[model samples]
Target: MIPIALAPASPPERSAWRRHRFLLLRRSSQLAVLALFLLGPWAGLWWVKGNLASSLSFGVLPLTDPFVLAQSLAAQHWAEATALIGAALVLAFYGLLVGRAYCGWVCPVNAVTDAAGWLRRRFKLNAGSAPPRGLRYALLAAVLLAAAITGLPVWESVNPVTLTQRALIFGGSVAWAAVVAVFLFDLAVAPRGWCGHVCPMGAAYSLIGSKPLLRVSAAHRSRCNDCGDCYAVCPEPQILVAPLKGKAGSGPLIQARECSACGRCVDVCSTEVFQFTHRFDHRRD
Candidate 1:
């Protein structure tokens, strides 16, 4: 007599778009930012100009990187009123909303590192040797110090972020090798290593958005099954520890500045435990 085989039960997704809802939105936003920059040289529709460091929108709205401004000041470099205003605008925007979300949502280099991370996980690779998170701050300090010592904004010359964006718009250059090195480092050296613990830009933005209005809260921890899926997906997994495990006194919010607000935890959880909320929402039930 042949025995009947029972199929394995597959867990169902909670939303219409399934687990990929936020991921899709994030990818589209990243690509769209790149497109706006490229549209000028590529299609002759110059909606945005000058890249993320400093950009003018339709030749009016100016956006600049506050960190770059800081480095310039450290280097004893003079800044015009427009640059000051532009940096303030960019700082205010990041402060009020996304924080280091730029690292996850807008950075052009994110595409390569993310692909490396995905491939790393697919191969079930080990964490390998990675530097401590404090290295990011060290790198940040070093960049400023280099600027001061050299009397120049040194990092801007070879920053992989700008290199990647420029390479995207223009044809590839020697910077392609740098971009490829980052991909290989993230893939083989360590997973999520670059953005999570290495990029000074991400570290600076994390500080800028240290008290951002927008945040991810483990609001419904009661529904969590201790499945560890969120931990696996989070770029800064350490941030989730306190919020998810904290009792009534610990607050339900993940307040770590390093939390990129990338929403991968929100995307991957089968139980729908995480949600975006204001910083004050401490619904620890």
Candidate 2:
């Protein structure tokens, strides 16, 4: 267990809880969202009527993945008014609250990749000659172009995120195989690589929620010990470098779209260097 920022006067149990607090909360959120989808089919409770890609809660609150919507639009597929509203709601939620948050909190594939990251850490492994970070953008462009060319939502037809969920619900062998391949790729080839480096959907989220209001700020940058633990734990380590220690423009609020706003940095920093703050609260000095 990493020793996060803890009050010296706090008791041991409290300290332990504090260290793992955000991580536990995140896991709970992830599982709860998954349960919501499962509840409809498993227990005959139609509270939500779809998977993460698209869902309507209580038969009213519609939510749709805007990236999927974008692909559909590119492929010249026209969605109804309700689906448009759902996409707008999703965009507003992610834009107002957190960017790329889906990657960290709601994506089921996140658990798979997180497990891979844990295994990599346990084995003391290092990524070797990984593809350029910009490959994701290229892939994003390629997917869009493919959609335009083929007049079909190509990625949606076979997206692992959706496939994994469908597999869990319907037991599709091909979907499970696709998911397992992703897990193995993350575990053996790259550490924190899929969402961090590739994933066109993540790129889309980052753009949609580019200047999200909820952000993880380096509020206590003065106390930083250069321990490198934050970098070690952060899925998007490059996003932290400028805010933590670099040129002045980026400020304490991590402005990069790639930031998932995952609290690992805050949870691991024993010196209390990192703290969550709004996008406007750039107290850099």
- After superposition, the stretches of candidate 2 with alpha carbons farther than 4 Å from their true spots are 1-14
Query: Could you estimate the TM-score for every candidate?
Result: 0.93, 0.91
Q: Cα lDDT of all candidates, in order?
A: 0.86, 0.84
Whose lDDT is greatest here?
A: 1
Model 2's lDDT to the true fold?
A: 0.84
Residue-level lDDT tens digits of model 1 in 41-150: 99989889888898899888988898899899999988988899999988888887777788878888887887987887788888666689999999999999999999
Error of 2 at 179 (Å): 1.6
Q: Give lDDT: candidate 1, residue 147.
A: 93
Global fold similarity of model 1 (TM-score): 0.93
Q: Model 1 off-target regions past 4 Å?
A: 1-12
lDDT of 1: 0.86
